[model samples]
Target: MEGQRSKVSSCSFVSYCFLFWVQLLPLATGGKVPALIVFGDSSVDAGNNNFIPTVARSNFEPYGRDFQGGKPTGRFSNGRVPTDFLSEAFRIKPYIPAYLDPKYNISDFATGVTFASAATGYDNATSEVLSVIPLWKQLEFYKTYQKNLRAYQGETTAKGTISEALHIMSLGTNDFLENYYTSPGRSTEYTPQQYEDFLVGIAGNFIRKLYGLGARKISLGGLPPMGCLPLERTTNVVGGNECVSRYNDVALEFNGKLKKLTTSLNKELPGIRLVFSNPYYSLMHIIRNPAEYGFDSTSVACCATGMFEMGYACSRGGMFSCSDASKYVFWDSFHPSEKTNGIIAAHLVKTALAQFLE
Candidate 1:
């Protein structure tokens, strides 16, 4: 009778163990991890150009010296972009493939998302200026992706996937940089403030579109301190060793307006998550207190020219290049270094992701 009792107790213990393991499975294997659907410009482009014919390509030398493989991975940054670190903090994966990449691993799309088009912006004219993928094209990609996802995971599952995922957007800088600043067409139509308003309208439209497509958690990035970037500092502006405050003012104004708009949007759409990552604040803080951020050369870039030129303009054979990249904040004329990306990613994780993901 004692043996029989012992056998029953063992069976009960085994059942408990099985249940415990079942409960721990998701946490153990990181099961059904929330997806990170990204959409933006070069600042967030994760090797999208590898599949495009755009001249905005960055899969070349001195682009990824700080990356794990020490080779260009088509990221506009010197190493990893903000999305890379954000994905890491989320514990999804390292690299998020561009939806357009011919080699894109579809299986991973279940856990990750990328619609960022390099050199793209809210304005249609911006794409023409850069001869790169446009925001409209990116949206089209998303539309097609929604179909593919439904096919892959079924309708109910796909809707749930999109609803649960975090939709990240970091655009508008290019609209200002390439169009409002340089292009004849946009400049003729709108002043700086007018252009800002127009772009914000586009941003709002984009958000609404995402909501229509079943996205709930949306993280829209505010423009960085554009005045401080090497590109803005060097190009066209006169007698400015320092950054142009006009650009910074525009960023501040746009971000402020967007914040207010988001509040209203939340009330309009209940149970929706709308987060804005203020890259303006984070980038401005580092620019103002470069030493504190561990960057001695905040004004200069590590690439050629080391001061103003960025993207294709920052070429080694054409101009000068710096030795150590760690000292500088700007990787080229436009984007942040991998270290800065890490810093920005850390803050974003806490602010934009922690609560949303939870």
Candidate 2:
């Protein structure tokens, strides 16, 4: 009884701290952020994949069923993703449009835009396999965005917006899962550690390029526990549907090196505020304590058959699609439900965003 009481007290104290930091966030940052610039994979893709001819897309029924107007917006979730929550938290906007979407023009981009594409990664080969936009191509679109911003909002405003914007990069899961593990060629060419180093080097160069283009406040998300995904669990039937420990071990090791890279970059670059946003522990906590986050299920997704359905396979017409997505941690095999994304965004606001904003 005493041990249980102590545990309850500790949890209460942590909750209080989280709420305190959330309340202090806006005041600490002075005013609303100028914009929310994003670059990465399906995690932050917004709706860019809708315009591209790719098999990895979610621009149809059941994808954005929980979002406003009940229309799919190419987001890989049942509703808004983390970047949408981050934009609102920073008082930027409710939604961040895709840079490639024709509906949004220069004025719409002045505040924010995502150049991300679904199924992309730090490795160009990963994007090639899926016929999605590569990170380098995203960078080119960002250059176009800068030019358009300069033309529409004038040079001074464009520079200030780009400098003050909260830039976010979320990639690498596909590099390991979709490319390194699936492709015998990549696996045969380099070991896991070597591949991680290669990806990190590419990430460093990308960040340096963003810095050259006038970005300062940047946050790069570390890899999650890939082994814990429903797809991974289903594929690991030999292990009795358990989370593959070896895959998770690789993620932990990569995150350690990525964190060190961020520290080194902070010292090496002048006036650059770069942060490594880690989601591994937080997502693990939610998976372990789903009841605390109002989730009834964590091991399976809410879409289609729950075990492996994703992208077009997880559709509204599927017979077994869950009636309530809020009860599940994941909407599809690989993406989190809107409720889970909200919880993760809140965690990032307190841990990662606050530090750089301060």
Candidate 3:
């Protein structure tokens, strides 16, 4: 009888410790954020473009030169992107793999995965321009991921992982830069304001769909200072190295609408934690004051001549490529350097991410 009583006490003690650990998890880490699920453009893309036939790909030398093993992994930057840093910040994992990568199976995805494709946007036309995966197709891939995850980890674990994961969407830049501004179709179809509204409408619906798919925590990234990009400054502001104020104004306006959309979504959807992550101010600050951010050049990228080179153009054979990428604000004409991405990620974790946890 005494032995049975001792066994019962031991079982009760083990149960108590398990409950205590579960309760301390949120406090020990940031929150109950289990995994980081990402969607959208090159800004957050892991390596989804590598599997697709697209000119927007950066899966070669000098791209991931600073990454582990100094080998390119299809990340646009010289190293890790913002999502990677965020994954580390949440204490989830060191790197978030691309969902389409054959190396990672359902078990790997049950932790975190990115459906983002370089050059893709909320507008399907933007993706068509470069033959990349459209937002809808990404959603389809996500559904498949869900099915596979359920099969591998059982329905309860899969459901909990999906619902507790932190979903991040970083798009819109490609829609404006690649589709609306560069391409004639969208510009002729709608004015800038109308285009902003159009994009926001799509974004709203996407968020709703994600919520329906069991995502409770979502972060939608707003547009950066597009005019400040090395490519934009080189092409838009002729004969000079000044940011195009007109383009910056458009980004600010779009961000305002996106912020409003997040607020509205939070109110409309019950039990949903939706927040807007504005990278504009942070990136602009880094550009305006490069020295403050330990950067030497803000006007041009570290790739080649830093005037007009990206993707295939920014190769290892390219002349005058900066030896130290940490000194440059941009790794390529169109994308921020890995260092810049890290800084922005840190800021988002402190501000926008805090709200999600709360």
Best by lDDT: 2
For residue 216, give model 1's deviation from the true position in Å: 0.5
Predicted candidate 1 versus true structure: per-residue lDDT over 216-308, tens digit per residue: 988888888888888777763474568888888888898887777788778888778898788778878888898885677887777776666
What tens-digit string does per-residue lDDT give for candidate 3 at 122-177?
Answer: 99999999999999999999999999988988999889988889999999899998
lDDT ranking of the models: 2, 3, 1
Worst 10-residue lDDT window, candidate 1: 1-10
Error of 1 at 65 (Å): 1.7
* Cα-based TM-score, every candidate: 0.87, 0.92, 0.91
List residue ranges in candidate 3 displaced over 4 A: 1-27, 237-239, 316-319
Question: Which is the winner by TM-score between candidate 1 and candidate 3?
Answer: 3
Model 2 quality (TM-score): 0.92
> CA lDDT, every prediction?
0.75, 0.85, 0.84
Model 3 steric clash pairs = none
Worst 10 residues of 3 by lDDT: 1-10
lDDT of 1 at 308: 61
Best by TM-score: 2
Query: Which regions in candidate 2 have their CA more than 4 angstroms from the true location?
Result: 1-24, 27-32
Candidate 2 residue-wise lDDT at 18: 37
